[model samples]
Target: MGFSKLFIFLFILQTLLAMALTQPTDQKTNIFREYIGSVSNNVTFADVPINPNVEFHYILAFAIDYTTSSSPHPTDGKFDVFWDTHNFSPSEVTAIKNQHSNVKVALSLGGDSVKKEKCYFSPFSVDSWVSNAVSSLTKIIKEYNLDGIDIDYEQFHADPEIFAKCIGKLITTLKNNGVISFASIAPFDDDEVQSHYLALWKSYGDIIDYVNFQFYAYDKGTTVYQFMNYFHMQSSNYEGGNILVSLTTEGRGGLSPENGFFKACDMLKSEGKLNGIFVWSADTSKGLGFRYEEQSQALLAVSHLHSLV
Candidate 1:
């Protein structure tokens, strides 16, 4: 009887150990991201304070697949640097990453506009566009020493399937070729945009890392209650993806930080649903002394510590 009891005890101990090892730990992946150099206000990585406790990413505003000229036009899938390269160059990226071991730099693709014209996906064909995009973006990613890519195409001339295939293939190729370690999709709540991104999410949700939903693109004066509802909606739409909370430094729209944005975040964190926070444009933030940026990092840092305990 004692031998049988000892055997049972050992089995129970092993099962308990496995359960403990498998429990989820989210503290390591908590992140704080910001977009910079989009407005050309001379904002560099050094201008933003880096918090050592949180995983921080500096997204270079845009590397649009368009020609650079007085009147820019799309070049099928070829990308050119549209951000403030003089202020945020390859050397600067290296310097910042070297300075902060937790820092990573990624480039955004297909922003809202290029030289006043609406930027569209406008790919000739999925195969050709993927080919050109892979080649051109590989060059730019290498040149900038970037770690990832964020899709921010605001408009699309192509159909939803075409957009999905083109982007899904591009991200797959980049990851397989070891070009990028992470990829994200930025989609707001517009009907057309939703259709296209939802198609992509359905097909490639396993590969995409974060849904940087433009929460700030919503109407101004959003209440904390409404914000929480919207968060649940997008979380359901994207399903298992990490839906990050956002606010623009421009205060152009969405839930303003001064008006209880952090309070909503606290609620999500308490529920273990808060993934991360991203701010729009570090350019406008410089004038505000980056108070919101500091607050965001501090929140993530504190949450990380709490998770450890």
Candidate 2:
């Protein structure tokens, strides 16, 4: 071959090698397969009937309340699931996973702490929470055969480093466990949460799957511009892959499906940055033709090539 031809061949070879060296979607498969939703922990799996029509890749069990500190720490694998904490089974997870082959169901830690202070606050700082909670959390994930853990420890005091460190360790350890397929952190469009979580996302983002940002329940992020900005900021932190944008399904959100939510969804989908949509609840939208879940899924169903390279 001539000199120019040989040079072109070498350039192509090097580019292919570089692409090969890069990791999968986020050190794993592409998380943005279809869509994602959350089933509120307020009711048991039995309470909410599954809609055969709706499809989602992930469905996070809304939350688990932290009651007391026992051996292995963090409520001893016993979760306040559904309505009541008493009487539960790991089979619940199996049954849910059995519902959808692609759907991953993981237990979320912490929810709105209106009645209680926080399941993750108080004596447990980032270090303490991770150290103490690891054993029991591991036991739960393994025994339950659950997909992964969702870190929603929102009642943080002043320590962002500990929070991120604790989360980073949890993701690393859980990923090491092998059963935990995915782990996610819940942050909102706030300085405190975003700054701390950005630390984790920047450093150990490869280990985690999605940053399930609570785009509602906050004062701001009501308009299309606001919503776009919120998603943009969250997406900025996560340079790995698509970040899941969760909005309130019930009347909890300020943005309307006919307005801001739809506009943002379209823009994100077109950009190929949209991962999926997560609705705050199943309880409110499951029955009586509420259509909250249905509408959100439809808006997120925007399609584009995963890679044009």
**Per-residue alpha-carbon lDDT of candidate 1 for residues 1-309, written as tens digits (9 for 90 to 100):** 599999998887777555433332343346889999888777789999877777888898899888755233677788889999899999999999998878889999999987887788888888899999999999999998999999999888899999999999999999999999999999999999999999999999999988899999999999999999999999999999989999998979999988999999999999988899999979999999999999998888777666654
Error of 1 at 191 (Å): 0.3
Best by TM-score: 1
Worst 10 residues of 1 by lDDT: 19-28
lDDT of 2 by residue, 19-61 (tens): 5333222212233321123333344554443333233443444
Model 1 clashing residue pairs (backbone)? none
- Lowest summed lDDT over 10 consecutive residues: which window, candidate 2? 27-36
lDDT of 1: 0.88
CA-only RMSD, every prediction = 5.7, 8.0
Candidate 2 ranges beyond 4 A from true positions: 1-65, 68-89, 120-128, 287-290, 299-309
